[model samples]
Every structure is written in C-alpha cells, then in structure tokens.
Target: MTPKAILLHLRLPFSLFLMPVYWFSISQSPHFDVTKACWVFVIWHVLVYPASNAYNSYFDKDEGSIGGLEKPPAVDKELFTVAWAMDILAIVLSYFFVGAVFALAVLVYGLVSKSYSHTSIRLKKYPLLSWFIVGLFQGFFVYLSTQQAVLHPYNSLTNNLLPAILSSMMLWAVYPMTQIYQHEEDAKRGDRTLSLLLGIRGTFFFTASIYSLTALCFWVYLPLQQFLLFIVLTSPTLVFFLNWFRKTWLDASQANFKNTMWLNLLASFGLNALFITLLILQK
Candidate 1:
C-alpha cells in the first residue's frame, strides 16, 4: 500500500483514545516494569490497533467519514498484507515480552478485531454482538492484557478486575454513540449498526443511562481521591456532551462529522491527560 493510504488506514491518531485504557491498567497494577509496559504500549498501538484499523478499512472502503478521518483514502491491494504482517509482529512481540498467555490474548484480540470487519463473519452486522465485542475486547481485554504485561509473573486478577470492568462499562456506554453519525453510511452497507437500532435520541439516552451506572460504580468502588480526580478530568467531556446533545436535539444536522470529531478529540485528550496524571502521581 502507498504510504498515504497506509497512514490513513492505520488511523494512528485514533490510538490516542485507546492509550488511556492501557495507562489506566498500568496505573492500577502494583508492579510496573516501565520497559515491558512501553513495549506493550507500542505493540498494541503501533501494530495490533493499526492492523485492526487497516483490516476494517480494507473491508469497508468507506468513502465518507469514518472514525479519525473525515476523508479516507481508497484502500490498496497491499493493505491486507500490511495488516496481517502487523498482527504477526504484535503476537511475536507479545510472546517474547510477556509470555504464552499474554501472546495468546493478543492473538485472540487480533482475530476478534479482524472478524469484526471481515465480510464473512462481519460481527459488525449484529448490533448487540458488535457492541459487546468492541467494548469487551477494547476495554476489558486490553486492560487485562496491559496489566498482564506490566505485572508479568504476578497474580493480581482479583485486584485488577474492578477497574477493567469499569473500563469496559465506560466503553460500552460510549461505543454506540461513536456510530451515531454513521447511520446512513452503515445502513447503505446493509449494516444495522447499534446506533441505528437505538436511533439518535435513543443513543444519547442509552449512553447517559450507562454512564450514570458507570459513575455510580466508580463512586462505590474507587478510592475517594481517584474518584474525585476522575470526575474533575471528565467534566469537560460532560459539558461537551450536554452541549452537543442539546444542539443535536434542536437540530439533528449538528450531529455530523465535524461535531462528532470535536467530541472524540475532547474526550480522548481529556482522558489521556487524566490517565497520564494518574500515572505520574502513582510514580
């Protein structure tokens, strides 16, 4: 594939949104090997995530806006080769840095991600299944994988489970909303996306409800300082969400690519900052 196509397909900038998950996992772990953690981060964001993005872009060949890109380039024949190569590299690196179990988890994540966009299985076609798979793998699985990598040879599943679950719940709450602006495009491809099934208003309400539960869980589970920090860091997104929701409610056209991108940027950057601060404080 051409460099431009590859870059666009990789959607590298979008990985910023996912890095917070890994950061959160690392922050929660009692053991932190900076070297191993860095390797894991690179493996996930550079190889694994890009592979998934390339695979999906190759299959979708989306002409309109997709996540991260307003105007995606045409897919190239070599994109598939690059994607598979990255997947293999990610698995190999995972095996060496962590162990068999961690590598297997990475392998499974890669397979699941491929299936989500692969035409044969096309897990994306099923709304509930799609939502669950994306949230579970991207949130819970990634969190666990990062924790495993950071704390290799240590058993702390009990300690780590709650944060992972909370991360997954947060992802589930936001995942469908990501598809809100893509209803027409998704429908055109005969993909009944979760957002389409929920409708615009329903998507917002569903997200709000899930987020409320997630907040409640955090309040009950997380330490007071951490919970307060979470609220403080996430407040901007809350403000933007309310403003965007109101605008969309007043004029559905406001929920287009531009506004959606603003939402993504605001949320991703805000969370990234939060997690990075947490990591620093933990250190």
Candidate 2:
C-alpha cells in the first residue's frame, strides 16, 4: 500500500470526533500531570484511535465515504502491519512513559478494538452487542482509564461513577447517529449496525432521549450556576441538533453525510469548549 493510502485509512482526522472523550477524561481526573496527560493524549489520539481505524479499514476497505475520508483509499495487508505497529508502540510507550495501569488500559482497549473488525471475532456484526460495547469502550472505559493513567486516583472508579456513566451516556447517544447516513451500505454489507436496528427515525429519537437524560444528570449534579453556564455554552450544538432532528424527522434524507459531519463538528467543538472551560475553572 502507498503511504497516502495507508495514512488515509488510518482516518486520523476522524480521531477528532473522539477528542471530547480525551478532554472529558483529563478534566475529570482528580490529579493531572501535564506530562502524563500529554502522553495519554498521544497514546490514544495519535496511536490507539488511528490504529483502530486502520485495522477496521484493512478489513472493510470501504469504497464509499467512511468516517473522515469522503473518498476512502484502498487498503492492503500492509495496513494491518501499520496498525499492529502502532498498537505495539502505544502499549510500550504507555508502560515506559506513563504507568503500568495506563499500559494495561492501552492493551485492553487495543484488544477490544481488534475484535471489533477482525473476521474471526467480529463484534461489528452484532447490532445490539456492538452498540453496547462500543459505547462502553469508547466512553466509560475511556474515562476511567484516562483518570487512572494520568491521576492514578486511589479510588479510580467509585469516586465519580455518575460522571463516568455520563461519558458513556454521551457516547451511547451519539453512536448510532454516526451510522444513520450509512444504513443502506451497512445493510448490503450484512452488518446489522445500531442505526440499522434503530431505523432512521428511531435513531433520532434514541439519540435525543439519551442525550437529554445525560444533560439532565449534569443539571442535577452541577451547581445551578455551573449548569446554567453549561446550557449557555452548549446552545449552539443544542440548537443545531434540534434543527437537524426536526429536518430529519420530516425527511430522513436530511440525515446524509454532509449534515451528519456538521453535527459531529459542532458537537465536538461544543463539548470540547465546555470541558476545557470547566478544566480551566477547576484549575
């Protein structure tokens, strides 16, 4: 495979969509070492997430638009090689530069990601199961791991389960919307994605409900002033989502890639800004 093709297959830009999780993880950690946090970011955003994308691309090799690429480049065996190398590098770096707990987190996340697309143990084929685990892996698991990797919180888990669960809730809410535009392609490929199971309209309802619940949880958890600030900060994304949902409800065709990508961009920007503000305020 050419360098360009392999790089594109890595879908590095797609990793931006996952950044809110990184920021969420860091902000929630009880302790923050800038060095450890930076390495954690590098391990996940630079190596782990892209490797996951590459591995999946090696197997799927989609001709149509994938997550980041509008026209995806073809994949080959070397793609898997690159992915494996990245995963190995990430784990090794985590162990050396970060900590053993961080290293183990990288290992577990890598294995689970490999299973998602590997033909022998393809979790992507099961709609509900895949949906459940992807949310858990990318969200709650990420939050907890990031906290441990950076902060080594003596009580990594119970100290703040509701927030960790909120992370998962946010992911669970948005997971299917990413697939809403690809229902036909996934169906033809025999992949029963969460969006396919939900159907276009049901997907909208599900995303809105879960997202709203998460927001409400934040409302209850945060002080009145902080929650009000959140709503204010999140207005742009909220308005866009409601508008998009209304349009999609009228015509599922509105759920096309262009609109979907816009939503992803807006949501990522809003969430990142929100948490960064929170982090700064905490500091």
Each prediction's total of clashing residue pairs, residues at least 3 apart in sequence or on different chains, is: 0, 0
For model 2, how does the per-residue alpha-carbon lDDT over 153-239 read when each residue is reduced to its tens digit?
Answer: 446467768878888888898889898988887877778898999898899889889889989998987778878877887788788
What local lDDT does model 1 show for residue 176?
Answer: 81
Q: Which residues of candidate 2, in runs, are more than 4 Å off? A: none
Residue pairs clashing, model 2? none
Please list the C-alpha lDDT of all candidates, in the order they appear: 0.86, 0.86
lDDT of 1 by residue, 66-111 (tens): 9888898888779988999999998998899767777998899999
Tell me model 2's lDDT, rounded to 2 decimals: 0.86
TM-score quality measure for candidate 1 = 0.96
**What TM-score should be assigned to candidate 2?**
0.96
State model 1's lDDT.
0.86
